[model samples]
Target: MYELRDKDFIFIFTGPNGAGRKTVAQMSGETLGMKQVISYTTRAPRSAEFNGQDYHFVSRDVFTEAERNNEFIEVIEIDGNRYGVKERDVAQMIEKHGAIYLVLNRFGAEALKKLYGNKAVRIFIYADLKTIVKREEDRGDTPELIQRYTSHYDEEMAYKDQCEHIFENLDLAHTVFDLTKTLDDNYLHRNLVDKD
Candidate 1:
């Protein structure tokens, strides 16, 4: 069992819809014993998604008010829906767990990185367009919505180079293993360098 020791990190997981970013973030959080940060969204919840569990579901008015109050670390509007990460949520998680994970859009991830500097690890999980389309369909997304989301695939792919780590989630087991191994290696390497 590889233990992370006293190392603390904030992982920002970002990918296009149906790329399994949330699922992977949750799995990684469980493996690492870190808390996953829930984002606020004005979009309606899908089947089986609970309020405050999957997302902090809110109305546009509330979301706008939050934005006006400067409560969000970052915010983005996608497909006419608003999504944001609150500063208080991240601060609470950091204070409690010393580590936190966020499933964020590119804008949110960029903002988090700018705010946290070396503490933020950007992980980009990706799959082929065909696989993404299939997964979106499997998740009960309408064809029209999937098409609209797919149109942004190129833009999402462009962010791959911006990430510190990239994982392909086609094989969940391998993906998880790769993430853990990378983290372990980085931690060990950092410790060794610090000792020297």
Candidate 2:
């Protein structure tokens, strides 16, 4: 286990797709004043997703070059589609916002932990498999893509115990409350240390 950081830093929420990670991140971001780091992905965008806003949609070749250059801190392939969080984007977010929030996969979260150690707070969010399938369908994921995702969903959820904290997003309000409480408890204790 790692001790909490001396200063405010990033909070990472990661899990399988449809685990309400992004939704909770956005909600907590509003409450905590943390900015998000938009990730880069080679996957084709959904109909409602906008490039840059949702993800920096890139070609495989371009993404490969960036990966080779170590431009991305973490990269993972999901069913032949590449997704990663760019180091530059994360740096920019941290520079602008004292503390940032991230919605990433297990690979990305682990990478961040290796990079930042205890400076990063890692939270794993998960839900029932049925809820996951329903959410994916509601999001318009193709049947094949959903199949690919569910195929390894258990593997993804297996990493929850590796995280610093885990939350089951069965209820949004409760998850949000618990997340905020975790943050507040840590932040408060850190502040008390500062006072001492």
Candidate 3:
């Protein structure tokens, strides 16, 4: 088993909806002992989502107030809902847990990369259109929601090349295995060079 000795970094997972980004992020975080940084959103939670586990669900007014106070590192609107990551929250998490993971869109990933530079590891997760559609359908997404997600598929895929790592998530186990290995390798390589 490969263990990550160094954890002063940020892992930003960005991908289109229904691509298994969240699952991969959660699994990899668990396997590697990294903390997952939850974001705040104004969107209502889905059937099985918990308040803080899935997201920091908040009202539009509250979110707006935080945004006006410049509390977020990055904020974006998707499907008529606002989502953001607070700067203070990230700092606090990193203070407690050396490394943290975040599930964000391509825009949010880009913003984080700018802020953290090389400390931000940008990873893009993707899947075939058919698989994405099937997964969303299985999750009970409405046709309109599916369409909204698929419409942005091309745009999201285009950003994959910009990421430092790209994973095509087909089989969950295989993808998670490969992801953990890649993360371990990257960590080792970076630490080895730092010692030189």
User: Which of the numbered candidates is closest to the native, going by highest TM-score?
Assistant: 3
The lDDT per prediction is 0.83, 0.81, 0.87
TM-score for candidate 3, residues paired by index: 0.90
**How big is the positional error of residue 102 in model 2, measured in Å on the Cα after superposition?**
1.3
In angstroms, the error of model 3 at 8 is 0.9
The residue pairs found clashing in candidate 3 are: none
Residue-wise C-alpha lDDT for candidate 2, range 1-196, written one tens digit per residue: 2233355577899887778888898897877667888999999987777897778899999999999998888888877899998888777777666688888888888889898877787889899889999888998889886787778778888898999889999999889877877876775232212211
Query: Which ranges of candidate 1 are over 4 A from the true structure?
Result: 1-6, 188-196
What is the lDDT for 173 in model 3?
91
lDDT of 3 at 142: 93
Give the top-scoring candidate (lDDT): 3
Compared with the true structure, what per-residue lDDT tens digits does model 1 show for residues 43-113? 99977589988999999999999999999988899889999998888877777787789988788889988
Ordered from best to worst lDDT, the candidate numbers read 3, 1, 2
